[model samples]
Each structure stands twice: as structure tokens, then as C-alpha cells.
Target: MSEKKNQKEKLWGGRFKGEAASILERIGESISFDRKLYKEDLEGSRAHAKMLHKIGILSREELQKILNGLNTIESEIDSGEFVFRSELEDIHMHVEARLTELEGEVGKKLHTGRSRNDQVAQDVRLYIRNRILEVLDRLDSLRESLYLQAERNIDTIIPGYTHLQVAQPVRASHFLLAYFWMFTRDRDFFQFAASTNDELVLGSGAMAGVNYSNDREFLASELGVPRISPNSMDAVSGRDHLLQFLFAGTQCMIHASRLCEDLILYSSQEFGLVRLPDGLTTGSSIMPQKKNPDIAELIRGKAARTIGNLNHMAVLLKGLPLTYNRDLQEDKLALFDCVETLLISLEGLEEMIRELEFRPSRGERSLKEGFATATDLADFLVGEKGVPFRTAHELVGRLVSECGEKGETLFTISEQARSAISPFFTGKEYDRAVSLELSADKKNSFGGTAKARQIEQLKIASESLKTSSRTKE
Candidate 1:
């Protein structure tokens, strides 16, 4: 008799005189995608039922029966034996309807002191939290793969670029490690996003606190959330956590897109700085001899989609009056698509990086063509001749200009540099500036492209990957 309190013969139909139109039924349904939240919904229900029983709203026997019904419903849905009707509107409705069918009126009491507003918020938070853990694990694996890639190229030489022009000669390991750090920052962002979602938000019923004396901490611990939300009104309408995750995803994609763009250029016939593995490339439809960087190109464009999705989600959250609006329903699609895009993009980019081969000879030669060591030449004058840097820079520029006019290289015109050395200089010092290998070696400042510093960086990067993350469990 208690289970039937205020219970309508047709559930929510007690408030309406007639059934909804067929078009309204179709327009209002979310079972197509929100059904993915069934597991989250079921888990939250179990926690709620246990809490309700402890607080004496649900008797022990009633709790067991309700839980059993929920378990049966989960099995049916997981096994694809349960049918979702559009008229049911969402996962919460379909799940509650099935629970009532299986356990009689006692199932109807399962929703006591709760509303779909708070329930959906809790379900989506759990979903994002769990997915963040998955992405973190994948990032760890990708970090390991990057460490291996850097190790293989520890002694390899490459031209480091600035503004798409070769700027300096560097150990290829250093180049790879730059990306390793980029991903490390992305990993940090994901950890922060996960922390933001770790707070449970389930007891806030319909923009206000639930009527019963609900133990939110107990519910949060049962649900594996580390904390409970502080405000009921904010809890019911919160989408900021989802926004933060999408922002992190967009940033990760931007990092990957930068690498993809580089590989696309490097794998082209003109650059030939690196070669893409055949498995990751596609051939041109008409040009039989052409192997195209289609994967890189696609991943690059997908980055834009992730960015657009973030922008779109921000627009949806903006101007909302607050406390669970219908517009919030549109968020799941953008968040889901953005998360999926980053996961695939990250994994694919890691594989491409792992398999690609660098052409050391071409990269080494490019260092010369772009005057990558021009600054090094100036530094040499400052160090050896005590020449003020500005004067040395001008003197080197004039000397380089003369060499360019005669179609000569710095390597072939060491005498010009010797003649132009400051009053404190010797003729033999200019010889060191001409060698690209030595030019790179002489840049021994910390974080420089010097081989020794890069080797030291490789060790730091390796240790970074090995250390356990500080992320909240």
C-alpha cells in the first residue's frame, strides 16, 4: 500500500488529460544515445536504493527485491534482450518501467527523494569520470611509445624548425621529446578534468535539495566518486565539468594536429625529411606511383572538428537560465563525439610516430641550407672576440651576405669570417663555426639543441614516463 502512494494508473499521465502526439514522442526520445547511460543509471540506482534502505525509507526486504529487479534489467539490456520504446523518452524512464514490471509496485518506490534531473547529472558525471580513466591509461601507453621512439633516435641528427624554416641542428631525440612534453601537458589537463568530475551530484532533486535526509557522502563513496557536490541547485544544472573535458580534448587534438601537419610536410617529395610507413599511407587513385599521407591529412582535419565541438558546447551552455534546461540534452552528442575524436586521433598519431623513419642525411643537409647556425656564428664572435652581440650580429650578417653573393657557403668561406673577427679574435676560431656538427655541439646552454643537453633531456623524459601520475584515483 505504501508503494502505491500518489501512484497514477499510467505513471506520469496523472497530470495530463490525453496522450502525447506521435510526433512529440519521436521528438522527445533520447533512448537512441542516452541508453548508453543505462549502466551508469543502474549503478546509481543500486547506490540510491541501499542509501534509502539504511535511512529506513526502504525496508531491507524491499531493497533486496528492488535491487534484484534492477540487476535483472541490467542483464536484459546488456544482453540486447530489452526493447527501448521511443515513447519511454530516456534511459531512466525505460529502466524504471522495466523495474516496476519485474518487481510489482515496490519498484515504483525506488525513485523516492530523487528526480531525473539529478539522476541524469550523476549518470553523465560517472560516465565522463570513467572515460577519463580510460583516456589516462591510453595516454600512459602512448607516452611509453614516445619514450621508445626518442631512445631509437638518441644520436640521430635533425634540423629544428622555426616559422617552418630550419633554425638549428638538433638531436632527433630532442625533436621527439618536444612532442613528448606536449602530450605530458595534455595528460595533466585530462587529470584535472577527471578531478573536476570526481565529485558526486546525485541527491540534488530537481534544482533543490531532496526531501529526505540523504547521506550524499555514503552515496558518493559507493559510486566511487571522491567528493559530494556542495550546492543542490548548481549540482542539478552543472555542465561545466563536461565543458572542461571537451576543452582538454580540443587542446590534445591541437597538439596532435601540429605533429600531423609536420609529418604531412616531411613525407612529401619536396621535404623528404621523414618517410611514412606504408600501413599508415594511401595511394593516389590516378597516380599509381603516389603514396599519399591521407591518414595524417584526415587526423589534421579532425582536430578542427574537436575544436568546433568545444565551441559548439560552450554556445549551448551559454545563456541558459540554469537548473536543468532541455537544451542540456543536446550536450551529450557534442561531448561524446569530441571525446571519441581525441581518443582515436591520439592513438593514431602515436602509432604513426612510432612507425615513421627519419631521413638523417636530408635533415642534416637542410641545416646548412637555412643557415641554422648563423646565430652560433655570432655567438662565436661574442665569445672569442669579446665583440658586443649587436656588433657581432651585424658583422656576421654582412659576411654572410658577401658569401651568398659569390654563391659560397659558410663552410667554404671561413677566411671571410676570420678576417671579420673582432680585435680580440684569432684566425683558427672561425673554423669551428663552419662545421654544422660543431655549431650544434657548441650550443651547450641548458635546454639548447646541444647533443649533451638533449641526451640529458631524454633521461628526464624517460623518468617522467616511468613515475606514477599524481592524478586522483
Candidate 2:
């Protein structure tokens, strides 16, 4: 039967005596996932065919037939008419098989000097290169969402926390800008990954140099890459570019998960710092009052998978003494998974952030009980009263404890009780020292949460976003 012959007719089966068992064939098959690389495979093949024709490997008539054949195959795959066969193995083999079916001998000549090893290397680099640019766009969109949100809430003050306890008051814009900087770094990493993919690996056939007079640099230009791999062995064996993308994806996911964690906490009724939009939240089936931050919670949980994928690839390559090994085939699994996971998380978080509604009043009013301005009081004592910092710290600590015991704010403390520690203490000075607005304004050093500094940061970030967008950075 044709099905029976298909198993023994594999491209690499010339030396084998028998067909692989069905289970082994199923185990080795990558068509299920690597089919996603069809576009890159087709692109590389066309470039290879053109290079062959330029060097007189194929006649003018044969090159035209090859081009038409490849175009038809690409259309078939794009229009959902292409049939993927497990027997053909990966995206590359499938494309070649279809090309041969279309153009006979010329299609067969397409693989004249290239090996699947180098072919797949090129395909992965191309795919990752495209994905790197795509992820940067998403990151920029998310940054824009945060930027607009920060602009809208520029003067809105809310408690800032350290160790889960309120430490000081800051503009809501200042808080949002923190995430802008985090993802800016992530964008830089993706750009680095893009630069790493600039080398061509297509001419490094089967882990050694090919015999053809192929123009690797010309092929690089056709593929929009800047250079060719220097050594064939390293070109075929190296996967550091894929690793760079995976590592960048993992770090981005980590940052996104941390942002989601903050969203989860802020949306909770206990904190009530932000309100989740009804469309982005879920309600409990049993509890009438339950509204959950399900999207953010899911993002938080998905981070473990990305972190695991990064580790999986790192460990997969740790022991392989490879010029090229069969084990490398599984690298696509991690790369594809990490890329998709990060994209989904980025898109979802951007939507949630765009719809987020902050409840600044609730957070602002809680600053007194938590003594968020205590440090300001200490600073005033140190500068105005010349009290030793440690002495001022101890004095503030005792007063804070006493206020808590009496179920009162520092402003409510008796003047006699406050002055007992220092002769310079007075009601006016105490009120000014404990003022939350003055406390935040006092943070005027660079990168601080002072309102003026936040405005300056916002202007710089907005301009950076505009420049990067125009330049496609």
C-alpha cells in the first residue's frame, strides 16, 4: 500500500534496513508543532533556490518552475489546503516533498547542497527574528497603556508601601511609571535578541561547510540579515539565539506576573486600592458578593510555565556534546511555548491595565494610621532640632506605639506627651512634620516619588516611546 511505502521512503532512510515502528515514528514526529514554522521554511527554501540558480546549478527555465512551485505551496499552506504528513517529518521536509510533487527534478535539486541541519537552523533564526520584533510591538503597546493611565492620574496621591505596610504617599502616576521602566528593559532585551539573529546559518550544511559555490552573504541580504555564520560547525550547532529569546521571554513573564500580583492585591476588598472592571473580573457561582481578579490570577500562575520552559532548554543543552544532535529537535517545543505564553500574557495584561480604575481616596486616608510620614517627622527633628537620627528614630517609635495603644493618630497625641521627649516639640511643628503631602514632596532627589520628578520622568518616557516607535526600536 502507498501508506506502507510512505514509512520506508523517508529522506534519510537510505541506509536503514527497516521502517521505524509506529510508536517510534509518532515519538519522533515534530510536524504537529513545527508546522508553525512553515512560512520561515518556505522563505529559506526560496532563497536557497535563487542562490542555486545564480551559481548556474539550475537553468533559467528550471528556476522559474521552482519559483512557481514554491509560490503555489505557500498559498496552499496559507489557505488551509496543505496536508501535513507525519511521515514527511518537519516543516522543511514537508515543503520539499510538496515542491518535488510540483516540479519534479528541479524540486528535487532544491536540496542539492543544503542539509536539514542548516535548513532548520535558518528556519528557527528567521522565526525568532520575526517574533522578537512582534513582541517589542506588544511591549510598546503595553507601555503606552500604562503611560496614558499614569498621565490621567498624574496628581492622584495614594499610599506607597514597603514590606506590605504603608511607608509614604506618592502620586498614582509615579506608581504606574515603575512598570513602564520594567517593560522598557524587557524591550531592550528583545532588541538584543533581534541583533543576535542577524547572522546567516543556511550555508553551514550538516555541521560542516557545503561544497556548492553558494553566496552566504548574498543569502543573508535576501533574508534581511547582516552577516553569515563564520564557522559551519558553530552555525549548525549553536542555538544561543533561541536561548536568548527564551531568556528574554522568561524575564518579561516574571515582570508581568509581578505586576499581576500587585493588581490582585489592589483589587481585593481588603486593600481597595483599585477596582477591577466588571468585564475583566469573574463572579463566584455560590457567593453573591464575590468578584475575583481571575485574569490577573491566571497570569500570575502562567509564569511558572515560562520559567520552567527556560530552565528546560538550559538543561537540555547542558550535556549534549553536539555538532548537531537529534536532541536539538525538542528545542522548538520550548521556544514556541515560551513565545506564545509571553505574548498572551502581555496582551491580556495590557487590556486589564487599560481598564483599571484606581480608588485613590481610600488609600490616601489610611496614611495617618500607618504613620507613613514618620520618616518625615524624624528628618524634621534631625534638621530643625539637631536631634541625633537614632534618638529621633527612638522618639518617633515610642510615640507611634503609644498612639496605637490609645487607638489614635500621631496628630492626636497630647502635646505634653510628645514634648516629654524633646523641648523643641510643638503642635505646629508636629503637624507640619507629620504632613503626608510635605513628606512626599521632601523626596526631591532624582528617581524619587516627588511630584515634580514624576512629571519629568513621564515626559522622558513619553518621548522615548515616540522615538522608539518611529525608529522601530
Candidate 3:
């Protein structure tokens, strides 16, 4: 070969007669970010090499040498000894080049029935599969923390809100478990994402089935994946699994943001319904008395980035033509960011929840002051006194209006003033109607805020964590 041909072969194989421009090399390189896939890439290569050997494309000696070379490369990357080059373009090329350097021509045989397209697709699927388990584990940790908090505060009452105004009284445990269940659904979403990524895409070649009769079943078994891609073109081109992973992260972050919002609001002096642990909070730079929930706030802020990441993946795949395109290179930017953001957020939120302190007195005081027992009064009149619900609602509305005008609460209203509202509004019944503890306990229906229901929920939540642990096993 001529020197130019040799140089071209060095860069990419002998497919080109002219040199690639520096700008094209720079712009085309994904080594900086896609290097995150080195482990996955190396694993896929090892599996493909074994498959090639099974099909008689490689001698046993060649297969052993390639596996040894791959193991060494993995160690180099793990120990930060690997040097990634832009000229190599991506993790797939980097691993191949290093293997070729270590094993000579035998390393070149590793790609016998594989293409960068299918290789990259397989790497991403493996990456997503591993990450989904991690996300689920973190989610389980957060849920466990919530369960413990709920167990500790099963009888502690707090004002529940609709439109951000106190609407009713509920046990503090019920409030915490609301988030527990949201995270539970987030866990389900991640598991579904994992299932979607469980297929092996190797042996699909570039965009069609390879010429060799490679044993994809053996490849799948070696890689620990359960299924093989049914269509070669779809195997190389599909990114639905990646999109699902991003969507799952986006949903988990949204739930984290909501939990943060509640903690931020409740930890404020005006609400004072809860206090975040001092270790989880930060001191203000200028103010001596400020303990800021900076971690929660940051987690809340990062939720937007996850949302943007999901949107990025969705839009990136929307207009691409099938079988593989350079546009797919951008997919990892969102995928990796969402994974990091979500894991960190889950860890931070779990730490915060584990140490959270609920101020039951403050919560009860707020519930009393906000007329959170109004619905309980309405229910008492309808159930005990046989009063029509609309009449009871109107009567309670008037009583609340009067209390507001006179700066008197239901507990402070006089017998005469109470009876004047209605014949059913005697002081004794009014007293029973407005007891915050009784108000919360009276909601004894299934999934209600009563203490018994909370106990039942805590049992269910514990079982859920155990079930998840078994599933993981």
C-alpha cells in the first residue's frame, strides 16, 4: 500500500483514499462521553468473540487470546491507564484498537460478525439494564426511609392541603407514605425500563443480519440477556429502551422534586410542621440563624434537568431515519445525565427522610387554627344527627364564617352561639366534631388517614420492600 493508503488504513480501514479532515475527526468523535460505555463495549466484544468461536470462525487459541486481551483492556480502563483518542471516535473503536494492539491480528477477528451499530446498541442496552437496578435499589432505600418515618409518627396529626390551604387533618404517617407510594410507582417504571432493555443485539451486523451463522442464543446467554432482537435492522436502530430509561428517571425526579417542595415549605418558620436534619441543611453565608435546605432545593432544581433530558431523547429520535444514524450519538448525553442526577437525588432524599423530624404540636396547632376539622363536623352532622349533608355543609360554613369574623375558633365558641347556628349544633356535638384526633381517626375507610389504616399501610409498605429485595435476588 502507498503511504497515504497506509495512513488512511490506520485511521479507519482501507475504505478511503483521502485523509479525513481534522474537523470531521473532531466533530465525529464520541470518545469523550461514550467512553462511559467501555465496560459494556468490552463485555459485548467478549460475548461476540465467543459466539464467533462457536460458529467456527475462530480457533480455540484465538478465542482465548481475545478474551485475555479484553480482560487486560478492562483492567486498564478500570485503573485509569487507558488512553482514549479522538481518532478512535468511540468506545467500540477504542476497545478494538487496544485489543488489536495486545492480541495482534486475532483481535481483528473479534468483529467478524459484529458492526459498530449493533455493538453500540448492545452496549447501551447493557448499560441501561445495569443502571435500572441501581435506580431501583436507591428507590427502595428511599421508600424504606419513608416507611420508618411513618412508623414513628403513625398518630402524629398534620394538616392536609388542597390548593395549598389546609383542608383536613391527617396523620403525619399518611403524609410521608404518600411519597412512599409515588416512589413505589417510580420503582415499577424503572423495572419496566429494565425489561425493555433485556434483549441482545449482537450478530445483527451493521443494519442487516450478518453473513455468518452466528449463535445469537449463545451470545445472549453469555451476556446474561434473556432475549435476542427479532429483526436485525431494528436491533441496530431502535432506541426505545433508552427513551424508556430516560422517561423513568424523569418521573422519579419529578417525585423527588415534589417531596422536596413539601419539605421546603414545611421546614419554613411560617409552617414549622417539620424540621430537616441540621447535617442535611446548610448554614447561610451571611445570616447566622439560617439553616437552609440546600440539598433538597438542589434536588428539586435537578428535576428540571431530568425533564429536559427526557425531552432531548424524545426529540433526537423523532426525525431520524432508521438502521442507525450519527444522530444516535447524542442519546447518551441525556441518558447518562438522567442516571447520575436521579441516583444522587435518591440518595440525598433518602438521607433527608431518614433523619426528618415532625413537629406534631405545630401541625396540630395549624390544623386547629385553619378549621381543618370542618369536614369532620359536616360528617358528624350527616352521620350522627341525620342532617342532610348540604344543610350540614351550609351550617358548618356559617359557623366557620362567624368564627373568622369574631376571631374565635370552634373550640372557643360559646354554647349559645354554637346552638344558634342550628338545632343540631349543640356544644357537646360541636366539641366532638372539632377534636383533631377524632377527626383524623374517623376517616377509617380503607386507604384513609386513620391510625389503623396507617398501620395497615406500613405493613404493606414493609412487604413491598421485602418483595423488591426478593425480586432483586
- Per-residue lDDT, model 1, residue 234, is 93
Q: For residues 1-473, could you state the per-residue lDDT of candidate 3 as single tens digits?
A: 32222336453557766665667777888999998888888888888888888889999999999999999999999999989877788888888889899999988888887888888999999999888888888999999999999999998999999999998999999999999999999999888888888998888899988898889889999999998899999999899999888888888899999999999999999999999888999997799999999999999999999999999998998998887998999999999999899999999999999998999889978887899988888988999989999999999999999889988888787778878898777756778888998888888999999888889989999999999999999
Sorted on lDDT, best first, the list reads: 3, 2, 1
* Tens digits of lDDT, candidate 2, 321-400: 86999999999999999889888899999999999999977776678778888888888989998999999998888888
lDDT of each: 0.82, 0.87, 0.89
lDDT value, residue 128 of candidate 1: 92
Error in Å for residue 116 of model 3:
0.3
lDDT of 1 at 143: 77
Off by over 4 Å in 3: 1-11, 420-427
Estimate the TM-score for candidate 1: 0.90
Cα RMSDs of all predictions? 4.6, 2.1, 2.6
Q: Which residue pairs does candidate 2 place in steric collision?
A: none
